[model samples]
Target: MGLVELAFSDWIGTITLNNPKKLNALSEELIKDFCDALEELKRQSVRVVILRAPAGSKIFSAGHDMRELPLDGRDPLTYTDPLRLAVRTIEYFPAPIIAMVEGSVWGGACELVLSCDIIIAAEDVTFAITPAKIGVPYNISGVQNLIITGGTHICKEMLFAAQPFPVKRLVDAEIVNRAVPIDQLETVAQTLAEQISKNSPLVISLLKEEIRLLSTSHNLSPETFERVQSMRRSVYDSDDYQEGIKAFFEKRPPIFKGK
Candidate 1:
């Protein structure tokens, strides 16, 4: 069976992550399937898209598949990376993509939710950015998404602490559009999608593009861009990066030393 399942009706296309056993880890193959699904939905002229998991799941996503991560000192999140591309696809998708989150979102998956046009989550939902926990250097664009959605202070707390932010906090920070009861999550998400689907697709598309452009409009000087890359490179090239991946596979806490 495929890792992603797609259903379309009433101009609303729903994409479900079907790999529950793996906690819907965003593997390369899964991400490719997701991207393809999005393209197909666009071709079909779906006015709205809802990205979700099966009902009653305890995890929306565990984030990137750790086993697929490169442990050989190579950058794991280059612009051409599958997960990065998938996030970009979500960001640039013509219609609104609603993330119907019912469980904890971690790692790159947290970035995925933030990339969506809107997020309607269960009251018990939580979000955590775990790059620090695994010594991964998050890219500038990803960091910008977090900052745009939750502000600089919230982004710093999540990245620095590598802890879960509860639904109340997420809503308070304006990261979640709506926080409903667990059982009402699907209802709320579906209702919103239906309402959005009834709107003018062209207007929504243009507005989404405008917002995407403005949100990501910041430019950096050549020297500053190089400096940012160097800072991220330092993390990925460090012994801490190696230790973090090792500890994850070894099921132990990594002891990171400033190198």
Candidate 2:
């Protein structure tokens, strides 16, 4: 079976992550398949695309496939990174994308869902951004994605603590549109997509582009930009960053010395 599967109903398209064995981790291959699926949906002019997993999944996605991460001193989330590509594809996709989230989302997967236009989640679902836990310094754009949803305070909390938060917290913060029973997840997403499909797709597409441009709009001095890059570079080049990946492979907690 394909790692990513596409199904359609009228003007709506659904992309299901089929690699439950890997907890649907956003590996390089899976991301490639996902991007291909989106391209196919775009060709079909799907008015709304639903990104989801199969029913009753206890862990929607484990986020970035750490095994694919480089052990050498190199940036893992570069422009050509798989997770980065997936997030950009979703954000720039003309159609309104809906994240049908069930179970728990972790690390880069949390950023992926937030990239979608609408998110319908299960009540028991959880969300967490865990770069800190693994000693990874998240990319600036991904950090901005969290701040866009709930401001700097929420962004700091999730990134610093790296703990799982119940779905209600996200709903209260307006990050998630709704948290319904597990059984209602599909129904809610379908209804929402149907409503979206009935509207003017052209207008929606324009608005989506406008929102993307506006939200990401910011003026930064060249020095400030270079400083940020240097800071991230310091971490990725440190021994702690290397230890983080090593610990994951060893199934042990990383012994970080803040190098």
Candidate 3:
């Protein structure tokens, strides 16, 4: 079926990214389905939400649908970007949204996972923040999201290096709550979700919002905001950016010219 699947049992809601053919890429349609699932779960008063992929998924998500990315002349990850919308939806969800990760998470998908209240991952899962690899100028808000979850130094490593890091190590960094063996991932995530569902939903919701507010309260002055935007604009407008996208489709290493 659907690119995203929703299920509810015992007050715990499950939202599965079901587009395995595309590695659950966050296309506009997929994000729309995901948000709708979250909304319906909210309406049904599901006490806790588990956002995941199907069991044993090899790639939890391939991140943003590169095909949907705008070419130069427009900001790619704008306010209304599907990836941004999905991250915001999870951040503002009344219930605690837990990311139950079982495979490699890349690019915008990692941002979505960080927006979740708790992250439980399989030991073999790896996360890569890859805008740099493709020469995309990542947005400031997205970068801040990564900093909040992973701290600045680690975020720098992830973004600059454009490489995947083991979920097991991220657990020690507090990015992930637990990194259990793949065999134990389902049990661990389910137990955590059920435990959260057992809590006072009202109080938990209040706390979730409060924590979300405080954690994401980074305020940038107008001048600072403009500077960040200008830098991102320059990157996206450069020849290197176009070359990167082209190379991706051609399945070859991009030959970036420092334009």
Candidate 4:
């Protein structure tokens, strides 16, 4: 079976993590498939992407697959490395990406949502990060995305305590864009996406960049700047940038390939 279920309609691409029997945990194959799917969506000019879990399950994800983790005694970075790439793909995706959290999210699952541009959650959803409890360092790159997009204090408390925060707290902390009744979560995200898609994709990307630049410390120390620059250079030089410019002059919606 496909590790992820991808469907597109009305310019919206929906991706559901389908390993529900495993609580939708992220495995090497899942991460690879997810990244590949997002890359394909980037090529297809999909205006928006919604990430969700399978039906009859509220647990969006429980994080990494401990059983599948590499046990060759090699550096664990191998696993985290690929996962980080997946998270970055979500972060720099030109089009708007939304997290539709209809259930529980924990560990790397939380990290994934934190990467999205917006998060819409079910009212009763539980959001937690349990890395500390597992004795693993919460060193994901998306942690900064969480803190900057969410809140500094909120990030600190969550990381330090590694506990699940209620959906209401997630909304209050601004981690999630909004929290609605379970039945309304999808509607909320779709509404938000529809509103976003009406605007010029070129402008949306520029606005995202301008906001990200201001919100992020792009001018940190020289070393840090290099790191951030390295992380984002591909986006700057992507085909989407070229299409955006062409679309502006042509007075039409540009199809971005995310090259």
Candidate 5:
């Protein structure tokens, strides 16, 4: 069976991450399937798309499949990486995409949720960007998404602490549109999707594109961009980076030395 599944009805398309055993880790194959599913749903003229994990799963996603990560010094989240492509696809999708978040959203998955047009999370939901824990240097686009949603203060705290922020805090930070009881999450998300699907598809599509463009309007100079990239490169090339990933697999705390 595919790691991702898509179902459509009444102009609303639902995509469920189906790898409960792996906590829906965004493996390369799964990401490709997800992108393909989005493309198919767009072709069907679905007015709204809902992304979620399979029901009854405790983790919405544990983020990227760490086992797939490279220890050979390549950037895992480079622009052309599968995870980056998946986020880009969601961001530019012609129709609105809503993230129906439950359980915990971690690392790259948090960026994925941030890229969605709207996010409705359950009360039990917790969002964490965990690259700091693994010494991974998060990409600029991902960080921008967080800043756009939650402002610089919230984004800085999330990235530096590498801790989960509860749904209520996210709602306050404007990252989450609403936080509903766990039992009511599905119903609320479905109702919202139905309402969105009733709107004119063309208008919705144009509005989505306008908002995406406007949000990304700020441009960084070439030299500044290269400087940021260089800083990130230094982190990924450091001994701390190796120790972080090693400690993760060894099930221990990483002791990072500023070397």
Candidate 6:
């Protein structure tokens, strides 16, 4: 059996972290499977995605594979190495992504959820980041994501406290979008994905790019701005734009070519 599983239907692709026996702690094979699944979703032009785990787990993920930690329990830089690319993939994926989380989410697991465009958690879910307690500095990318989702103060608390909090508090802090009953987590996540999938694909892709530019454009050099301008020009000249306008005039939904 694979560490991760992916399935698609009706323009929505779902990825499940399947190691429920280990609380779905991400492993080496899981990382590869996840990236491969994302690539497949891109190829299929999946309009939306929902990430979740199989039901009846005591936790969503307990963090890294602690058994692989050094005997002296040193914080291994390699532990976070895979996440750099995985988080980047999550951030730059063309369509919106959502995380459906129940039970406990810790360390890298929290970082994973933060990378998603939206997070819907079970009301009883617990969240934490344990790197600080383990003598590891939070990875810079993960810290940036925490800041983006929860702001500076909450980010500091999560890292400094090194303790888990109920998912509702996270929702209150805007770190998570929805907190539904445990049984309703999948329903809510799927409903949100369906809503996103119903949009114009061209607009969804363009807005994702535009927002990504806006998020990272701060403190950029003039050359960077110029490069961004080039990207903007390219988007304007895309064949999808022509199709979109044609569809508008013809009173029909546009079939975006992603060109």
lDDT of 2 by residue, 168-256 (tens): 99899898999999888899999999999999999999999999999988867899878998999999999999998888879998999
| TM-score between candidate 1 and the true structure | 0.98
Off by over 4 Å in 5: none
Model 3 residue 41 CA deviation (Å) reads: 0.3
Which ranges in model 4 have alpha carbons more than 4 Å from their true place? 68-80, 218-259
Q: After superposition, how far is residue 94 of candidate 1 from its true place, in Å?
A: 0.5
TM-score of each: 0.98, 0.97, 0.98, 0.79, 0.98, 0.79
Model 6 steric clash pairs: none
User: Candidate 6 — what's its lDDT?
Assistant: 0.76
Lowest-sum lDDT 10-residue window in model 4: 70-79
State in Å the error of residue 153, model 1: 0.6
Ranking by lDDT: 2, 3, 1, 5, 6, 4
Q: Model 4 over residues 124-222: C-alpha lDDT tens digits?
A: 888787644443333435566677766778888887787889989877766688888877777788898888878888888787777776877644477
Candidate 4, position 87, lDDT? 79
Candidate 4: give the clashing pairs: 58-103
Looking at candidate 2, the ten consecutive residues that score lowest on lDDT are 141-150
Candidate 1 lDDT tens digits, 94-173: 99999999778989999888889999999988898999998888888778778988899989999999999898888887
Query: Each candidate: RMSD to true structure?
Result: 1.0, 1.0, 1.0, 14.6, 1.0, 17.4
lDDT of 4: 0.74
lDDT of model 1 at residue 48? 97
Model 6 TM: 0.79
